[model samples]
Target: MEHDQELNNNLRKVKEKFMLDLVDKLNRINRDGLEYGSSALNVCYMTSIVDKQILQCEEFLKDISRGYFIEDYEEDPTGYTNGSIEIQCLNATKTYTLKFTESYCGDMAQCYPSFKLSERHGVGEYEWNYFEDDYEEYEANFNKKYSAIYKDIEQKKKERRIQDIKIQMEMLSQELTALES
Candidate 1:
């Protein structure tokens, strides 16, 4: 019984660590832009790498949960629950903001494992699906073309060439942001 308790504690620690790492990676990607402002292939590779790490963590957690290595605990406001676990989990997942639900002081203790696990797996698939064979060839072509343009500009050393490129890129970025807004 003690061993089981220790294993459950370890699994909880691992899950918490993995969640923290995932958030950090997400923030880094958001700050760096979706495309890396460098190369499509480079961006694809980086995303794929992050995706694999998250996937491995997710799978490990799922296995642990399957083995009943973690226990679910929640605070009952009135000391008696009125809703099914499934309903509570679904509401928690859908109604809570990521900042609130996934925060260090979050209410994830009440969250349903099934919803959280499914969302994690879906995100991992979305991240890695960008690197499949068909998409890889497309990205390679994009990288080759854009990189060649950049290389040509460097070889010529035209006056204010890099600055002009930067300005254009900035304008395009602004336009994209405006469109999204």
Candidate 2:
């Protein structure tokens, strides 16, 4: 029993750290407009819903069934509960927003939660079924793309560090010559 508790505590700590890192990355992306790239964003979005607890709220189900979802945030008398995020995508020429909505089961959102890229400005709504093989392929492809992007970023950082070190060495050499004179 003691061993199980220790393991759970460690797992919880790791989960907390991961969440912090994810939130930081999301914040950076929001501020800079996909500087980390869309593949990374997509992977992060999908990974968040892994093994989610489903709560079927009859209230939300009605709106969901009718094909209408809460697109924007609103403050009810009780509180503010908007389970939607507006993601901005910046390309070479233009910037646009994509809205992602969470599908939940229960009195509110995020009960047994899943996400969908429900709407895109200038483009229409989107639907992705999990049962489809195409969906699986799409997920795999997204993961692959994200992995590649991550590796490229790491490689570029290493190259940049090397360049910085060389510049520092040059500066140090110049400083030494001036001191000797």
> Which prediction has the highest TM-score against the true structure?
2
| Over 4 Å off, model 2 | 1-85, 88-145
Worst lDDT 10-window in candidate 1 = 95-104
118, model 1: CA deviation in Å?
3.4
lDDT of the candidates, in the order given: 0.37, 0.40
Q: Clash pairs of candidate 1?
A: none
Estimate, for each residue in 59-168, the C-alpha lDDT of model 2 and write its tens digit. 22222232321123212234222234432222222222223344444455423224433222343333232433545565565456456445544454556668779999
Candidate 2 global lDDT:
0.40
Winning candidate number (lDDT): 2
Please give the RMSD to the true structure for each candidate, in Å. 18.4, 17.3
Q: Which residue pairs in candidate 2 have backbone atoms (N, alpha carbon, C) closer than 3 angstroms, thus clashing? A: 53-112, 54-112, 55-105, 55-106, 55-111, 55-112, 56-105, 56-106, 57-105, 57-106
